[model samples]
Target chain A: MKRILLPLLIVVVPVAATVLWAWWPRTTPPERVSDLYRRYEHNPHLTVAYIEDFPVNDTLTVDVTTIRALDAAGWDTLAKDFRIEPLPDILQKKLNEGKDLVTTFLAPKVNPALSMDTTDLLKNNVVGISQLIHTVSVFSIETESQINAVVNYNLKL
Target chain B: MERKKLKGKELEALLSVAAAEPDGLPGDVAAQATATGMAGFDAWGRRRQRNDLRRRCLAAAVVSLLLCSFASVTAPEAARTSMVVNNGTPRAQVIEGVRQILEHKL
Candidate 1:
């Protein structure tokens, strides 16, 4: 019995340690995001990486049905029927309630040929009223002052 | 009769082919001829089993190679994340769902 128990302990100890190592709560804390961003600044393919502490089961939903293609025909249709009022207002309301919702839209580059206006509409629509922060094309657009730089810099794509 | 175990894709392929050629004869044949084809059917079935095994082994080797290469490239940064919290459904299911989504997108 003593010999059997000694061998069992030897096998079990390493197995338990490995299990703990694999499942350990190994996550980067929120504060280190800035550090991470600086580290990957030169990385073009690195794209975007930011953590959101959203409610456990809820999805960060983005309804792209209203997003019109940046063609002349599409623009005409959007100018006639483009509505950004409801989404921003709804997002503002959600933000005021202390819900965690941060969405960043990124493309290969910030140009007039990229979809930036839609994100602007989202930012102008909700930031003051809600805690939601909308960063578009690497430029932060939560403030009224920062809004113009993003709007001007963003190509109409 | 030794029953052979088949992986998911192989089983589907076999089921589809079997459904297509339920009767081994090219056209409608006499019952006697159909009965005589049982030996041929067994031979064809064995050939298919061997082919399926070969295909599965090749697929497995390719997948293993791809995974090993990917891991070698990414393994350094795998430990960089300290806390891996998933914001989805059941924990295990969410991991699988996220993996599928990443696989498709990547």
Candidate 2:
């Protein structure tokens, strides 16, 4: 009995663990998203920004004109906040040509630094402004009309 | 001594003897040859059948392997799930949550 049970446990345990890993339900913590919003609320730079035809089917399209209006100073500030380099000359030229800038953020792989829940919510396959912003505030809500967003940066110079 | 080639009479006599013999192989030799031919054909047929079976099984295994690979690649990741807000949860709550997360990250 001992011989039989030992091998059985060894085989069954791994198989069960694999199944659990594959099929487990993953979710985002609501509190994390809420806390982010609360912090934004307390920020002094927050402003109400508008985008025409908002929430156009999972795409976050920022008007190039709006970004250009930021001039050099505002643009530099934005670049610093996002932890990315300043926009290239080619991108600025394109923006001047009346184009929209779209950016998408992907979820991180499972790791200790980034939890599965946070990554999953941030990088859900469904494209939305919320996902791009890494927030849960605008989840599943779409508007046929233009909408306003409370943003921390000036959309116009 | 120098050997003499067959004379015209000698050659004629040999030809007459050969012409008098049967035109086809002897009966027993013909039967044995036919039996050998049939056996060869049978062996060839069996070999061809085995080769065909082996090719079909190899093709099936390759197809099964391809299908398994496709299924594994296309399957959804284990940790990803759809975001569904509870009925009791207000839309404002979700929006606030998203805003906070973005503020921290950005």
Candidate 3:
């Protein structure tokens, strides 16, 4: 009995684990955004990294997207485009709570000519709120060169 | 079939012949060996049992360790705060971003 049981468990454990892994859902978010990004969400040059909460299982979402532009003028338009984003009702309520939630950081580019010192100027936080900080980032690469910046948005259901 | 007291080599040869033949030994000789008992076989059996148990222990330990690692990696993390790292933004999402920007204009 012992001989039969041990070997059976060995074979069954890994197979069961594998089946569980196969059944686990690892869904990728759809990349079907349209129009807001200079209509360049389709452009190979426009790279975006997004992470949001699953509506079915989660409530809080912190979405950070970074985009690049040709110069300060381009930055203005792009930043303006982002600023006009609508606030979800929950986010609006947070803003109404009299809490200053803005925090942004700046990072340097790889090009020596484009490199700039890192400045995380906006680093204020509410100790009781969250550990993850910062919601915006600006990258200043040589005066007229492309600027890569990030803006984070929070959403809740 | 006269009764003959066979010794040593003769006994060995007879047993070898019986082993080589499909008939096994005659029923009377088989019964005699069984009646005498199997003390030597029992000693070897215990040693084999010990080795089997040791092998099982090692295998079980390795399997449990692997299960621990797999569980940790596959387990779902807490959803208290989510900062999903999404790559390759979809067109519809960007359009949503633009919509938000437009709303900000209001």
Predictions: Cα RMSD each: 21.7, 22.5, 16.9
Highest-scoring model, lDDT: 3
Candidate 2 structure quality by residue, lDDT tens digits, A84-124: 34458886686567553443233122221232245234332
Q: Write the per-residue lDDT of candidate 1 for residues B1-102, one digit (tens) a residue.
A: 334544456545554555576666344232323554444545665777677666665555565555445544444322322322212213333233222222
lDDT of 3 by residue, A1-157 (tens): 7865776677568757764664353432455321222243444433432323322112332232334343445444444534424447776677677543342323333221222344532321110111011122222222221221122223231
For candidate 2, the per-residue lDDT at A76 reads 44
Error of 1 at A68 (Å): 22
Instruction: Rate residue A116 of model 1 by lDDT.
Output: 45
After best superposition, candidate 1 residue B51: deviation in angstroms? Answer: 50
Q: After superposition, how far is residue B37 of candidate 1 from its true place, in Å?
A: 80
Interface RMSD of each: 13.7, 13.3, 10.3
Q: DockQ, in order, for the candidates?
A: 0.04, 0.06, 0.09
* CAPRI class assigned to model 3: incorrect
After superposing candidate 1 on the true structure, give the runs of residues whose Cα lies further than 4 Å from its correct spot. Answer: A34-105, A108-157, B1-106
TM-score of candidate 1 versus the correct structure, residues matched by position: 0.23
- lDDT (Cα, tens digit) per residue for candidate 1, span A34-105: 332343333332222332221112222111101212244433432233221334777568757865343323
Runs off by more than 4 Å, candidate 2: A1-33, A48-78, A107-157, B1-106
Fraction of true A-B contacts recovered by candidate 1: 0.09
Error of 2 at A52 (Å): 19
Candidate ranking under DockQ, highest first, comes to 3, 2, 1
